[model samples]
Target chain A: MPTSDDKPTPNTDEPVTGAEADKAAEIAAAKAKAAEEVPPKNPWEEKPVAPTHSDAMDDDDVVALEGLVVSADLFTGAVTATVDAEKILDVCRFLKEERGYAFLVDLTAIDWPEREEGRFDLIYWLHRHEDSKRVRLRAILGEDQTIESVESIWGAANWMEREVYDLFGVIFENHPGLERILTWEGFNGHPLRKDFPVEGIDTGAAIYPDVYPPGGGPIVPEEGEGA
Target chain B: MMNGPERPLFDVEEMEISFGPQHPATHGVLRLQMKLDGERIVEAKPIIGYLHRGTEKLFETMTFPACIPHTDRLDYVNAAHNNQGFCITMEKLLGISIPPRAAYLRMILAELQRLASHLVWLATHAVDIGAITPFFYTFRERDEILDLFEEYCGARLTLNTMKIGGLPFELPQGWLDRCAKFVDAFPAHIDEYETLLTTNRIWKRRTIGVGVISPEDAINMGLTGPPLRGSGVEWDIRKVFPYDRYDEVEFDVPIGTNCDTYDRYLVRIEEMRQSIRILRQCLEKLPEGPIMAKAPKVLRSPEGMVYGSVESPKGELGYFIVATEKGTTPYRCRVRPPSFVNLQALPQMVKGSLVADMMAVIGTLDIVLGEIDR
Candidate 1:
């Protein structure tokens, strides 16, 4: 993260021109004066304070679930628990039944094709409506690895898991009828993969406009007697 | 041939029928591979993705601010809510607070959008249920709402009216008065719709006790918005999460008791009234300040993830944004569309219901395939 400490300052060695130098000196003086002035208590500018309530998980603390949660961190307004891939089912059950995070808000995958930790991060967002709290659980999976499906816990995860399978090629073990949900069956590549081209690929069956004759279909080759 | 020996009377076979890749009542290109035992549905497997434009992928390639317009296309009918969800998530990621005026403006637009979306839902849902006249009446008010949207933003359906920090444009001159006028008279139109279908015998027969989802099943299925509320969940993100000044507004979260299609209908009607109440409050309390926050010229969020949701007309419209450290574009932007989640309950809902009642259930669900297929 690029904090204010890491921000680049103006080059001090460069000789400044007359008007520009004057403006720079004036800006420095204004900044010095502004620094001396006490900042107002602007409500909009208030930073997010960690909730004082007991139920809310502290961002900085690890849950200490020895085998299940490897590490937990709070960032960007939600607590994300990095769980052991094989133990995701156990962690989800714990959250749903014990912790009361019943509703599965969303299940999605983030593809990190170059990351050494894993190829993909399967994200599950669970919402506990009673406390209006949402917690995100992330399970790191290597290429071609499979994770247990949570359809038994949350029926809503059925389509969502299928979507992740369709778009990211992540397999969900025990997912009933895990066919493509967002893409047609027999579609070639996982489009959401980081390596997938934004312009899209030309499936050889249908000649894409950018591929064959512009503004038209595939060009059929002349019949050949001998090759 | 006619006497083909008792065509085996009482010998029942499950018939598999493919419904709607193009059928009118299926909403969009939602195709259901339904297995039927006589006229009763045994299984219904919805085949989606006809409208998938690789929106999440599209979001990846575009800059943060540029992704707002694409969000508009996900839930095209509820475009403002879509915009709101994306904008709110982006704002959370950037840690910027929008001005009070901007927040109120967003609420006004969002509530109006709720009205517009529900009207569209009512119009098409009624048309699907064979109530044709309500479609015309609902569209009249819907068109007025669209006109209001057009005056505020430049477009009606795909209103990219919201920005990441605040809003893209201020409310047009006299737009609020027109909106107030429309809000003032909107209940009478709801009354007209009610007079036509709320008590109609055919409407009741088509909707009541059909596609029923129990409250427990609804929560387990992760149903949100009206379907969950209709099942008596009493959960509304607007009230629960309270984004963009919703906590300051006064409106009831109408929930249904019977958990039937009729109750869902009643819930939606009551919801439109509640939207009006919210809209009236926003209009009265519209604040005065800069509409845009002091956001950076280019938006770049610190590494991590955030999930922000709004209670759209259909359900919880959420955006799960994952921004990498020092990145202008989101590493991943997942749209938690309500229709997609709500559609999961279809097989369960229609299992024992008649095939014809399928349309009624689809109507009651009020799904927009754009969101589902996204």
Candidate 2:
């Protein structure tokens, strides 16, 4: 039953109405006889603690890991690279084992269409469970490229890889089973790809019982069909 | 059927199930071509874009300032946060510094958006798991946030509040005090939701060990926001990247372990509390100044590119803008939607869980289909 924008509440944008205007006149008329009410200062005034940037080389990144890279981005210097696909599992193991970058913040792909060979960039944001220092890494891959799947490393990769495949068309080499995700059966192209038509599909898109070929959608939802 | 694990024509094997193209739990129109062995999932491949509106290409044709409202539809639930992220990016590319008051105002609205987003997460998460009452309780609070938005910016769902230079207008008077009151009472309200499901026996049984995403896999997969944090990752862009007044605010980044469906739920609940903390801090120290920066009446950004992202309730909501030397329209606009990346973890989490648990897992991840399909 909240009123629209023009009308106001006590804490929000206040308004003048028939009864309120009369009451306000009455209150104003009695101002000489009444003591004013002064509310306390706002409690939401507390400011946020300054955050630790990724380049700070805090204790969170100083892990004694087996194959940790300990490198920074050439341009920004704010990003740190601790592992690559070849050593993905080892690096993840080392990070989890040695340092406290326990939370895997996120895995997603950014496309740089201008780079002929280096078409897509896969980015990871790492977080330590104990604190909030972030570690960001960018892995460059070419067209029809593949990175070792980390499903074995992080159970969450199973879906992240599918999203990459769905949007950017970046293949994860060791992914258990990769196929179209987010798009329906017979969808003409990956919607997130730079070259992919944003308007999408020349046809009716997904059919309820649509059965797709390998690498397509409407995949069989029954078990034992695809391992 | 020897111990060979039943390769091809195994008739005595698992049963098949399809979750949605328009199912209730998928949130929006996401269809999961999920395979199952009886009630246990064998493989779950997500099929999205059922609601794709091509928000990116649409950006190319829009004026520099006209695109703000369109971005709101991307994650329809967190409209204010989405608008704020785009506004920051354009400001950066233009190199126009925002007034201290604008930053504080933006931060307050953004935090409010976070609270509202988390409320939706709780409601949908509970509803997916058949805890219908939490949805109602959560919506009641969400409505309050929506009310605040309607007063500040006339539109509720697709708020076009941000202009290229700064806000389209000043923060409506008294808006902060009302917001202050809501956030103050919000932590207690979050505690109520926790009491409803946090230690509830049925909730624990359904979520505890179901759909676990280990920490290692979560990192490699590129999951951002709370879902990634649920696996014990502490990377919040607000604390790490420190955009806007978030750098000045003090709050904790909540993390989780076991990376289970339930852990994600817990992480989000705690996150809502921390957001309240950020809000309280913002309101107390909000500087008094102009709510906007001076700019050319019409904007044409210099030819350059900038990546602007905010730690949105869903995840890292970002915008990559390529401006031409002549800045009337952007050369390209790309949205780094958190829901899109966050949704990627679904197949893995749901792989071995029941179809029912798949719904629970989806709810726990707290994805907005508009964002996922954008």
Which candidate number maximizes DockQ? 1
State residue B323's C-alpha deviation in candidate 2, in Å.
3.6
Model 2, stretches more than 4 Å misplaced? A1-227, B1-11
Tens-digit lDDT string for candidate 1 (A1-227): 56788944556798666877898899999999998897885555554322211222444223535556666776755678888899889888888888787899899999998889899999988888777777888899999789999999999999999999999999999988799888778889999998889898866565453445654656645466234
lDDT, residue A100, model 1: 84
Per-residue lDDT of candidate 1, residues B1-374 (tens digit)? 38556666687999999998899998899999999999999999998899989898899888999998898898888888999999888887777788888899899888888888888888888898888999899899999989988888879999998887788787778888898899999999999999999999999999889999999899999999999999999999888888899899899999999899999999999999998999999999988878887777777677777888889888999898888777999889989999999989999999988998999999889899999987
Q: Give a tens-digit lDDT track for model 2, residues B95-211.
A: 666677877878888888888888888888888888898998999999999999899988767777776656767777888778888988888888899899999999999899887
Residue range with the least summed lDDT across 10 consecutive positions in model 1 chain B: B1-10
C-alpha lDDT (0 to 100) for residue B208 of candidate 1: 89
Candidate 2 chain B, run of 10 with poorest lDDT: B9-18
Q: In terms of lDDT, which candidate is strongest?
A: 1
Clash totals for all candidate models: 0, 41
Alpha-carbon deviation at B28 in model 1, angstroms:
0.8
lDDT of 2: 0.73
